[model samples]
Target: MEDTMALQNDLTPVVEMKGITKHFPGVTANNQVTLKLYPGEVLALLGENGAGKSSLMNVLVGLYRQDEGEILVRGTPAEIHSPKDAVQLGLGMVHQNFKLVETMTVAENVVLGLKHLDFIPSFSEICRRINTISRQYNLQVDPRAYIWQLGVGEQQRVEILKLIYRGADILILDEPTAVLTPQESGELSRIIAQMIDEGKSAIFITHKMEEIKRFSQRVQVLRKGETAAVLETSKTTPSELARLMVGREVLFRLEKKICCPGEPVLEVKNLCASNEAGRPSLQDLSFIIRAGEILGIAGVAGNGQRKLTEVITGLDRADSGKVVIQGKDMTNRTPLDLIQSGVSHIPPDRISMGIVGDMSVASNLVMKEYRSEPVVKRGIFNYKEVAKSAKEKIDAYNISTPSQNTEAKFLSGGNIQKIILAREIGACRGLLIASYPSRGLDVGAMEAVRLQLIDQRNIGNAVLLVSEDLEELITVADRIAVIYEGRIMGEVPAEKADIKIIGHMMAGASLKGAAQAAAEAELGEDGI
Candidate 1:
């Protein structure tokens, strides 16, 4: 640590933003924020969902102009008014949602906007250069592979390669590991280390505390568009960082009551389904969720999680097998049929699937219940009752909004999620399926969502929680079932859940096989 600090003191920062401020319609996204990135180091920018971390980085990358303050590149004042200018000044940013042409090949996408390139560049030469950079940084990707043919991780590698191809020395990755599996995240850490070893600097923006510790040298915390604290990674704890980000003592552990499962609320037997391309997705899958327990489905993304949810909720067809709800066979039923049978869903894509963005909060709150009494009187719509009910739900769920009539799209991600939870949890009669409920939310909102799940379990309502976060599954789920390639790898009680074993299962290891491997490794460590 002493050597690192001493070395930093002797060199000028590779990139620096001094007192930068940016404003939106009614909000100050960034307020006089100062940030510095030294050469050969990874600095983590930590903040809540709406804490202006992205806004500040946008200013550095020329996506948004700062209202005040100046930016310096290598101790020289630099003007970056557009992305092209930022690239010319050796700056690059990879957003959470990747900017890639799905129909184009990796090499074509990499050299798409070079001013020096000819109208029809030499494909052979471009592929060779991409391969060379790929080898140098260990970022492997097929230059000829189309973006649509690659997985999420591979697409991300292409994004990095594009920046490196353009001579970018300072990289900014925004939530780089949000959708990656555990193994993929470790690979990214290696890539970052390689970049730093080659004298490149990075600003990693993330809210996950574990990622901050694992990937960064120093940590900078942002709260309410202002710098909260900047501390060395080795000298800080996750609890301290969480507290700093939320401006309060954040609780990492929740108080969970003992689970007392009741009769089966949902049963799927020998279920089969296929993806849109007619490829097998869920193969002979089966599971049972009881009346008073939270059954968590754990796996890497792109596994059969989405298909399983869709089939069970009547949003898609099942090739073969039965979906029984409350002792009635509901195979291939319509969404309304499932809803009437007391099945509520909080989908993975909240903006597109969970709520209507352009509609008023009051209107969205009563969407599912509008056909029932109190909301509809003698076949006539009741505006007064709808507004009254919306206000009650808003207060109960702690949804932050200016008015019940405000557009749902205008609210922040966390508050919008609350609106969904408020409606679904209220309408839940027998079973509730929540897919990545707390994803992309702040620490406070995450805590609230988990508490709601637990409360549902306490009240004897079954909950099926699907999440890629093993930590979250272990915290709130009573029993977790691992799925890989449309098959159940194994099930483990949450009380005895081991991360290594679960990770192995997620990678396609059966429960027994994973346990045996763990035991063998332990014995080897003991030299037995």
Candidate 2:
């Protein structure tokens, strides 16, 4: 303990949550949680997936009402029934997913719900205020630019600015750096330090042990909907924290041998695709992924990430491109055709592309294999056979659910990801195109997903991994390539790469010089 109570001598505790408890129909999300946030300190809420970190914060932020609890703001019990009330009480939250209007300008989003007598937001005044705030907090964001144009990191800065502009003293950030590059994460760290200097308190909810060590003064570990341990960040190592969080030691990386890539398994050449609005998504994109290797694509969201997946898997038609799958031309084929030809794809939007929310687990499990025998015969589905198959997959994949009839929406984020993994990875043969496979998964689920991907690579299957999570790329990817503005900037062996170099490339920096310089260095065995 860091004597957090003693640290609040003259300064009042900004937020005090005592005896908080919440329960879903079949799950206890939080149990008797007690937490106090001081005037100017960062408290990192540490937990694995399904660990109740988000549940506790959701209660505080008014997304979910606590079954039993008292929230005291500035030593007074405050009634916060909604997000609006939380904002009125000087409490703000930036969610794991950024909530911003794509068409709106930065200043507009910052002042979104506030009352303005005039229809206009006073452009010059808002700009001046935004500029001053940016300078004061080291939260640099262009106030005039459209939200959709900025990177994921920049968009999050705008979210933070929204809270600050609303006069928030107690800020809650959920998984703030889950998608950021190392450089951007470092910049965010500086910004948080500045917020504390200005006498603001922060609650950082994250699973990253490294971030807890770097930022928080005190760490609170939540396990299975309860506070398992609370300790000083300086007094705890990542290993100790991991042990407490998971109840055992968890191997952070998958050990594997390095092997030369076999013949090209999946090749894309001059791929041009369209966005949702019918404009160009991918423009002259070209890349090649080899068997027995993981080719990681690093890019900001909407740098043709979904479109790239669509074009390769035949969900969307390419204006022009050549997609070769195991010596067969798969360009412009139907999605079913691609799947039948042994291309297992874990699409980006899990709800739309991966699983059907209202559908039963068994129904979804055999969705892709409806045409195959035992699942389909004479246009009739074998429900008994499908249920058996689903049960087997669920047990093998460790999906935590009651039965095969359990709705996909009833499961947690990690379990949903598990279903996708079990379906796609289990069906794969020649290629696996996984996009953001571990987006909302807990650390243990993330590790399992990575191991499965590696297992596929070991079995001589090519994997195209597109994700914004840099750590996942570094951890599991054999070769990393930067995709900027719908083109491959450069490729590097993961073992020889650094975050600095890769991040710069991700931000659209040219890699011509570095690629030329590293031509000779790219040789030799460097297992990623």
lDDT digits (tens) for residues 1-528 of candidate 1: 122355677889998899999987667878988888888889999887678887888899998999999999999999989888899899988876688999999998998878654455589999999999999888899999999899878988998899889888899999887657667888988988887888899999876788888889999888888999888899999989889888888888999989999999999899999987999999998889998999999999889998899998999999999999989999999999999999999988676688999999998888888889899999999999999999999888767566888798766566777888889988899989999888767787788789999999999999999998998999999999999999999999999999889988998999999998888888899995
TM-score, candidate number 1: 0.89
- The TM-score between candidate 2 and the true structure equals 0.83
Off by over 4 Å in 2: 1-12, 100-151, 258-263, 270-287, 298-307, 315-319, 348-366, 370-377, 400-411, 467-471, 482-485, 489-512, 515-528
Candidate 2 residues 1-528, lDDT tens each? Answer: 234345455666788899999988668888998888877889998877667877788899898999998999999999988888888888899886577999999998988877633455588899989999998888889999999888777998999889888889899989888767556778888888888888889999876777888888888888887888888788889888888887888787678779568999998988887766778778888888899999999887767787888889988898887999998999999988899899999987675467898988777777777888788878898888898889888888878665788788766656777899899998898899999888767677777789989889989999999987777888888999888877777888877777666766777766765554445345533533
How does each model score on TM-score? Answer: 0.89, 0.83
Clashes found in each candidate (C-alpha, N, C closer than 3 A)? 0, 0
Using TM-score as the measure, the top candidate is 1
lDDT of 1 at 434: 93
